[model samples]
Target chain A: MNELVHGALYGTLIATAILSTIAMGIWFERKFAGRMQQRLGPTIVGPAGLLQPFADIIKLLQKEDIVPRDADRGLFDLAPILAVVCSLGVAAVIPFSPSIIASDLDVGVLWVLGIGGLMVIPTFAAGWGSNNKFALLGAMRAIAQSVSYGVPLVLAVLVPVVLSGSLSISGIVAWQAQHHWFAVWPIVPGLPAFVIFFLAMLAESNRIPFDIPEAESELVAGITTEYTGAKFTLFYMAEYVHTLVGSALGAALFFGGWDGPFAPGLHWMVLKTLTLFVLIYWVRWSLLRFRADQLMRLCWTWLTPIGVALLLVSAAWVTFGGTN
Target chain B: MQSAWLSAFAFLLVSTLVGAGLLGAASVLRVRAKYDSPLKHNTYECGEEPAGMSWMQFHARYYVVALFFVLFDVEAAFFFPWATVLREEGTSAFIAAVTFAAVLMLGWLYAVRKEALEWQ
Candidate 1:
């Protein structure tokens, strides 16, 4: 009974945290992007625009919900919900601290990768259901990018799992707790996996530098061209939530989740996750978007081979001379 | 010990079945009549009528890419379990794993040479 309650409570807490943090992320992303473009973004919506996300949600909810006249009604209505649900689902297995995981299953890593990757289905559904030329183009490009980049993303994630020797994420965190931090190791050494992971993280979250699917300038808002009101808000929320998930996962894998000294375990986990979140925002603001072909080439030619090589080197390191 | 593990697995299976059944029933019984509309039946546009068909056959490259993806993806899964045990297993096990990886690499290379990856 206690275990079940613990699971339910942590599940709800984590869900609330993810939703709220993502809402904040949207406000910050817009403000930062506007600053980069030399425009003031939503400053009137309460102190430094902190309440902008809330205001935007209220405005959207008040707007008249319009469905497309010729759209595939079922899928059109379903896509945004699917996107939000899939993104939120990925949060279930993530370990916030030693005692704070929602579900500590044996195949936790696989479960995350599997369900998380399904976000593309909803994205495609939006494109197909909207019945617009630009939406189709954007969705097509997105499908290409997601399928291509996702390979390296999974492989890069697997490197840490390889080092840790378990599919369970908490098990990996426990391994990191013992091994002087896996980041310090020399096998597939330095920060190649980390850098690759970061790039893949950006792609996965549909952030700038790899957000060609939703390229505003050329594709006219890309796959989300027709979305409006509360549905659009749901899509926006899902986008931010996915970003939080990617950042947290990256932190857990590379930055030693819940492992800092002088702080409580949960505090360390939150600090690391938030730090990565800020870094993600920094990269999004600091970089320009990549052309579609350039993005594809980077994934296949650079990231994938490096990920595969890291796996081999990591295997060799474990086989001979052992490891920390 | 084995019975304890088996019982735990059984419990998980039962719960999973119950959860799936409940979700299935709830979805079927929902009030669909109240929400049905002409706008809902049509393709999605901001407020106007939609233009044309949303589905178009994409380039053949995506299929090719997907095939290669499945090939390499399955191969990577085998390495995870081996990574955990390698530290204690020593050289003979290392050589066997290496040989296995080498064969897979050869298959990948052959696919590459055969223009399986020529996306252009």
Candidate 2:
């Protein structure tokens, strides 16, 4: 049809699909977490708790919308809305499979990184607007963690660009299909770069090991401390949506997205993305949170430097015709 | 070229609408209690009466680290163009980028040595 209508229509479709996928993620994590802790977990909601996430959403929506006194009402509302919007925005650029992408921007990698990085904004805003001591501190820690790892994250992502000599996600995937997946062929730098990317992704999403910001004992749920009901739920859902997008982006970058033996299509992309999503839970349930200093040290001293080294090595390899 | 951006803007508008729509529904569907207390709206503290203002000027630790992030993140952005053209430019691009990286690494080392990254 028209540009606005076409974009809106597809955007709605893609955003809804992502929201549903996030619902499934919530169910999967709960079930997985329950089994890990030796409990059945939410089996009462629907058939095997299939509908638990929706049920929870409805309940949350009906709860009182609490805004703390003197809270910056404008920004307090803006933060969670921005968080979810930004998370979903990245999905528009991701090349889900061969022809299944939404926008397919030539600078898809840039799209992913740029929008993904904006996540830091809503968080700091949430804390600032809340005007709570705990929320402010939590926001500080979360922003610190995300920004510190952001260097390595960009550095690591640069490796895939170096290998493929293109900034497009689909371009990288095509190059992998033609030659070898960066995950296996360039054993030296590819593996390490992927590992760094995964860790940075975890830190960016504020998952368990890097979740010092929301260390409930210390900050009382951190940035969302002053938020209640639906606003609070939006903040929570934003993180899950961020993780899901990161996983899909990771799958596209390193795991030879949508490349399979027998049937290569959207299913393989979904499978790979889901596999990484589960890995996130595995890390979350198994590990303890890092001390704030320890987390910063790990990013600056180790991941960032190592990420740079790997990027250089990959670039040198490609410059010298290694990919050819 | 313009179409791409238009579509992206449309996508953004649509997503915002969806978010606002959900929030609106929640506000519409929400339960408003009969009696409200000032205690409910007070910035959350651990049950004891809160003293002083919620906003404080302390905790500048994140400032230095955030500065480092801006430096490297911008530097990282510069690498994207160099990378896309690496295969074409070959060794020359590699050398130039490495020189740039080494300089940045030296700065990072200085930050580490100064204990800027340390939380304390």
Docking class of 1: incorrect
Top candidate, metric DockQ: 2
What does candidate 1's lDDT look like per residue over B1-120, in tens digits? 323223223323332332233234434532344555765645434556655566678888778677666766676667667666766776776787778878877775675577555555
The 10 consecutive residues of candidate 2 chain A with the worst lDDT sum are A1-10
Q: What is the TM-score of chain A in candidate 1?
A: 0.94
lDDT of each: 0.72, 0.87
Please name the candidate that would achieve the greatest lDDT relative to the true structure.
2
Put down candidate 2 lDDT per residue, B1-120, tens digits, no spaces. Answer: 656556667787877887888899998989998899878998888876777887777567788888888898789789988898889888889999999999989988888898877886
For residues A238-322, write the lDDT of model 2, one tens digit per residue.
8898899899889888988888778766888889999999999999999998989999889988988899899899988898755
List of clashing residue pairs for candidate 1? A68-B45, A70-B42, A70-B43, A71-B42, A71-B43, A71-B44
> Which 10 consecutive residues of model 2 chain B have the lowest summed lDDT?
B1-10
